[model samples]
Target: MPEGLIVKALSGYYYVQNSEGGQPVQCRGRGIFKNRGESPLVGDRVLFSETENGEGTVEEILPRFSELIRPQIANADLAVLVFSVVRPELNLLLLDKFLVHTEHARMNALLVFTKMDRIPDDEEGESIRRVVEDARALYSSIGYEVILTSAHEGEGMDKLRQALAGHINMLAGQSGVGKSSLVNALVPGLTLATNEISTKLGRGKHTTRHVELIPLAGGGYMADTPGFSQLDFAELGIDEIGSCFREFRERASTCKFRGCTHTHEPHCAVLQAKEQGEISESRYSHYVGFMTEWKETKRRY
Candidate 1:
């Protein structure tokens, strides 16, 4: 059997990119997969056999290093948390949510702050830059790389590319954060639909309805997905929430309780860190928000 990477799956068809590097071979999974309750996902390395009609059937899925259950993408190495600095403004709360998901997925995250050119050269611009710097410092302190880029002027794109190169990167952010624009800047002429009706797909601008991996110039492959705003902690437990925040995880060991929720616990290291300015208040707030949601969601079940 020949091995390949599943780059895209649409309407029950899996487009497997040949391992040797050529046009993707359209393939379908065997009926046994359904019987076994297993399905192929984009970014899955698969063993498949070519059919007489040039299509193929996946025989087996190779073991994945990491899999994101929410988006259903497998083996992604990094999540490029795309956001904008000016227009819609940067949402620290939302960025923290993405970070938690990326952390849970066991993948590195890169913060790409887009739309630098759109920032007005005035007092307001200074304020925006201040927030951006703050976010960059906060996330970088937790070991995430932050890159500021102006898609209009192509500034900082090289750095973005360098971070993505040779890695399975996933572009994840809310709509209107310039994810498409940044992808366009990185790969010219391959324009992605930016929330507009796409004639080619005959669908609305969410052409990436299903996650699709676009081949990059270098060895890297990027999974282009629909921009979504919300990530409910449906798959996460209340105890698992604290570990999602990197800073919280670091301080949790010294917490008074072995399995501290970090909420009103006596001698909690995480709370102490927040009071002592060791942890970002914004991140801690998000953690509380998630815990609340998780508690409510957990009770409903």
Candidate 2:
């Protein structure tokens, strides 16, 4: 038996990349897997045996440290949450939602702001730049690696590569945020499909419809997943929601009551941090909003 990583899965076939460097072997899960209620996912490490036809059979799936349901990837080390500064405009709330999901999944996250060149070089652009910068600062303060990238101009490409070095990363964000462009820039000669934003709808068509792990030039793999338009915390509890916010979680220890939801609670350390500007007000607002949303969801159910 040989061990390899499953890089792609499509139509009952799994493409397993060899650890010793060769063409990815086409494989199919063993029938036992189906009987056992186990299916191989991309990013899974497995033990396989090659058959005479030059294909392989995935015998067993190794343990996975992390898994994402939407993209259906396993054992990812990082989630590169890509966003744009303009043209499909930046939605901080959506970005935060991605962060919340990433953190909840116990994966490291890198926030990449793409299409920096799209920001005009004028007074208006300056204002927009400031807003982006401030948001970057807020995320950075909470210990996230944030990079400003422009795939067309080659800005921050090196930094982005460095950040992705030696880790299985998934590029996730809204449609038209240039996730494909960024991946192309990071891995040369891989011209992944990219779409222009719709002027009327203010969103981009989904260019990446499926998830596949593309080997990165810098080392490790990047899973380009279909862009998402909406995300809801339907599976997370209200208390779990607050814990996803790093700053809030840290300050939550000081709250007067145990299990503080960090909303409308007197002597709440998280609220105090918001009042003192220790936490981003926008972030806190989102936290509170998610809390309310989760509560309502629980009530309705």
Candidate 3:
């Protein structure tokens, strides 16, 4: 059996790109996989056998170190969380939601602020720049790699390329934030379809509808996925929510109780950190929001 990476999965077929690749071999999952409650996902390293017709049968799916839920990719080493400083407006709350998901999935996240050129040269632009700077500072301080980018001027393209080299990255963000444009910039001549932002709605229409890993010229791969605006923590438990926030997790051990929920608990180190200006109030608020949602969900279930 030859081993290859599953670059695309669509309509019950897996496109396996083997080491001796020409075109990807179209493969179908064996019955054993269904019996085992497994389905092939893009970025999965799979073992398969090819027949005379060039179609193949997937024999096994190797272990995955990381997996993303929304885009349904596996073995991705990084998630490039793209956002814009203008147009759609920087939604720190939404960005924090992405960070929580990225952390929970056990993959490194690189924050890419796109559409830098759209910032006006007037006073408002400067104010927006300050806000973006603050956000970059906050996320970087908490140990995330933030890269500033402008698809229009090609700024930060080199840095983006360098960070993506030798790793599989999933490009994700709200629709119209230039996820497609950024992909085109990083991989020239790719010419991915891009849509203009709806001025009335302040949102971009979805361009990339499905997930497919594109091989980078330098090295590694990037999956351009359909942009989405919302994420829910319905799958997460109340007790598990705190671990998603890296800063809170660091100081959780010092709380008064071993299983401290950090909500109205006495001598809670996380709460103390929030009061001492250590944790950003916005992030703490989001944490509490997730906790509240989880609690509500438990009640209904």
For TM-score, the strongest prediction is 2
Please write out the lDDT profile of model 2 over residues 4-93, one tens digit for every residue.
999999989999998888999999899999899888999999999999999999988999998889879999999999999998777898
What residue pairs clash in candidate 3, if any at all? none
lDDT (10s digit) by residue, model 1, range 1-301: 8899999999999999989878999988999999999989999999999989999998899998988876789999989988888656788888888887888887888899988998889999999989889888888888888999998898998888888999989998877777777777788788987764244542233445778898778669888888785788888887678998888888889998888899899999999999999997888888999899888988898
Show where candidate 1 strays beyond 4 Å: 196-207
Collision pairs in model 1? none
Cα lDDT of candidate 1 equals: 0.85
RMSD of each: 3.6, 1.1, 1.3
Superior candidate under TM-score, 1 versus 3: 3
- lDDT of model 1, residue 24: 95
Candidate 2 stretches greater than 4 Å from native: none
Residue 73 shift from truth in candidate 1, angstroms? 1.1
Model 1 quality (TM-score): 0.94
Q: List model 3 lDDT by residue over 1-301, tens digit each.
A: 8999999888899999997778899999999988888888999999999989879999999999877778899999899999999988898989988888888888889999999999999999999999999999999999999999998899899998999999999999999889999998888789899999998998889998678989998899999887886787777776668988999999998999988888899999999999999999999998988888777877888
Candidate 2, residue 284: Cα displacement in angstroms equals: 0.7
Model 3 residue 127 CA deviation (Å) reads: 1.0
Give candidate 1's error at residue 75 in angstroms: 0.7
